[model samples]
Target chain A: MAKQFDQRKETEYSSRDLETGCVITDPGNAARYKTGDWRSQRPTWNTLRCIKCGLCSLYCPEGCIAPNAEGYYEADLYYCKGCGICSRECWTQAITMIEEEE
Target chain B: MMTGKRIGMESSLGIAEAVKLANADVVAAYPITPQTHIVERLAELVANGELDAAYIPVESEHSAMSACLGSAATGARTFTATAGQGLELMHEVLYVASSMRLPIVMAVANRALSSPLNVWGDHSDVMAVRDTGWIQMFAENGQQVFDLTLCAFRIAEDPEVLFPVMVHLDGFHLSHVVEPFYLMEQDVVDKFLPRFRFPLALDPDKPLTAGAFFPPGVYGEARRAQDDALRSVRPVISRTWREFEEISGRSYKPVETYRADDARVLLLTMGSFSETAMLAIDQLRERGQQVGLVRIRLWRPFPFTEFRQAVGNAETLVVLDRAISYGGPTGPVCAEVKAALYSEPKRPRIVSYVGGLGGRDILVSEFVEMIEKGTALAESGVEEELLTIGVRV
Candidate 1:
């Protein structure tokens, strides 16, 4: 076959570095990993300290925590990355729950 | 009848002058602090058209390296300069430049890394990029830099060793030091190192693909090919360095072994620290200590065979690494040397000395202190953990 109008193949899988380029060398697989919303069984906590100190809600980078009944803290485990920063940050140490198997 | 004055310049600057002398086709760079002088002067040469090269102004160090890759692939003899963070930023392209087999030459001013952030003399930067497959050279002084800078192009462009080369100098020490050297005449340089023409390049007529994607099925094979190419570079490095000596009247070797012929304790070092270590060795010699220092010039290939042969008679091998592996006992070189020496039945007892890291000053006396610490371990006949050379606060 005669080659015509050759162009630089735009490889856009975007780990952006060659060392681990294989982590996303396959574009289709890379897209899946990117948009394939992860599932996690992280612990949800009832902040029984109940002092209503909004620290837990504010400190969660994931924003998984919110004010529940009586202004205690509650975590929505569905989207939590399970980084566990929330449990460690609870000043009163009122929230504790075990993780579930994946 | 005279022209430009004969002067020995810093290795990085020597490379810049040689690149200018070679009339490189492209000089792309991001302004990495320590490695700035090479690119800076090269930029001046380009501005004046003494060197007919495209001076690519890149935004980041990674882009700087990528520009060289692109330029070299397009059949231009491309060049670049970088240091610690810059080297880290360009880290991704280091292997690509090798696998694609572009004969790009770079000047790396070996500098300390950051956290506290320092811009001083050390091997931290180049050591961090140890296995990136580019032919790396350590200049002992300004003269080596001027000579090796020219030799680098000859070696990298040699069809047999068509790999990139990084001429390394310590940040402030060799990169900034001035010495006297017989500068190669431009016509002589042109005669010795001809224009680079890559056999496999991104030419329209050839329509070859480079840095292409490959599946897991063949990824390991491709890497193996790279390893094979690099492993075979030792001989090429020797031959080219000899050729360089023949033409330029300057000499070099893979590893420069000093006072090691009959020595019992051998100290291994890279970059500017080796000079200081030599002073320490002199002191130790006067004091009746059986010590010598081995300066590793060709780093990437690591010169395993030559290194093993060089330090053969030594009873104790003290490796002084400027950068720490964080968790590993020795600096990066010691670990690899251990792995290289693992199969050998008889080799020197290895002890690691970590010092001059993070821009800390490594004095000649400190080298003496390290030898004392190391020989102590050898006397006890125990393989000690990492030895910190100048760690006292």
Candidate 2:
């Protein structure tokens, strides 16, 4: 029941249909909410300097960074809030924050 | 009516006993005047092993309420007490408790707010957090204080209604008064208030986010949900009172009336002054005046339907407020009463009065005089924005 409710957008739910106290009954449902829309700057990673160390993934504030198929660390833009934490924490400066285009 | 022992005890101590009887799991509170005695007694109960509960001595009222929120989230039967400035300090956290739908019961010994630093009884503190979304109720005397405090837990923890409850008794006036009242047995109380089991309690096995932030897209809906939930709690409150009446032989209502059947003039009051107003009504009736009294018991949901019915037939209503709205309508309660009756076809002519402020006494004779003045004002059609009683100036 909770998972089904989580699948619907917040705006789609009416006051009567919402859970009591607006409590999110489903745990770890934050993954469903794409907080990346709030980001003005997106992270870009250089594969050469990445070294597959996964430091950027560990430092990502939103925990949206992960190792891609090639073992290079990449930020999942769908959930990243453009905090630039990964860029700042990258030991080799492999990640850089760039302004998003309209 | 199961006859329990009738004993005289201070109102504050009675409230503490009520909490103990309810078997509260957590009591997190800071000491403040008028409210201190209740918490002090609870602390003593915890110390003496009379009540098996945690007594957290917090640094400030803010921490006290915050601690209650945490404990309540974990499905604990939480209780606390505060007055005046302490209540003001817990202002912000008060909303969180209600919005989260935690069934925490608080006894507020209503006192005057400082500036003049008067540690006296008044409704100033109660009026300050009027819109904080708690289930607010007023207790007229020591027995009512004890009864209502017990009822608060049952009403608040009802699965249908999970709002926090505030049992407000006038500071010093009601809190310090020693009165004889029947104390319910622990076995009876245990049967009345079932073990609280919050459906959305914080548990490691079944995780859920409580009080999550709602952005602009959902904030209005969230507020609407809360408002509807609170407004719909009237039935639960009435039902709880009825169930309590069965065992306790005491009856309570949202709006209680005294000889209001054919009353042409009505005097409305709240808190401890209601009893005094009742005496004044008896005097007015003896003087051949068709007067009655109406005291508001449930304050939060406002009891619009019952209130309208009670005052609809009266020719005039004299509302005495313990707190001033300052520059606005003069009386916070008066403004609400007027608004509630604005659309009624047979509404009474309301004469607003702000009195009994900052611990000032309003004797029975004084209430009679005030009522007479109000009736005269209503009859004369004089547009006085505010009238104050017992003010020397």
TM-score of each: 0.77, 0.96
The local distance difference test score of each candidate is: 0.76, 0.92
Candidate of highest TM-score: 2
For the second chain, the TM-scores of the candidates in order are 0.95, 0.99
Best by lDDT: 2
- Report the C-alpha lDDT of model 2 over B1-393, residue by residue, as the tens digit: 747988999999999999999999999999999899999999999999999999999999999999999999999999999999999999999999999999999999999998899999999999999999999999999999999999999999999999999999999999999988889999999999989789869999887888887878878988999999999999999999999999999999999999899999999999999998999999889989999999999999889999998999999999999998878975999999999999887889989988899999999989998889999999999867778899986
lDDT score at residue B311, model 2, on the 0-100 scale: 93
**Across residues B165-239, which tens digit of lDDT does each residue of candidate 1 receive?**
998888877777776666777787788788767765665554544676555544665577577777787898899
- lDDT of model 1, residue B59: 98
Collision pairs in model 1: B7-B181, B8-B179, B8-B180, B8-B181
Compared with the true structure, what per-residue lDDT tens digits does model 1 show for residues A1-102? 212112212232212223211212222322222211343446455544646777777887766678766676776655556666766877777666455663
lDDT value, residue B373 of candidate 1 = 82
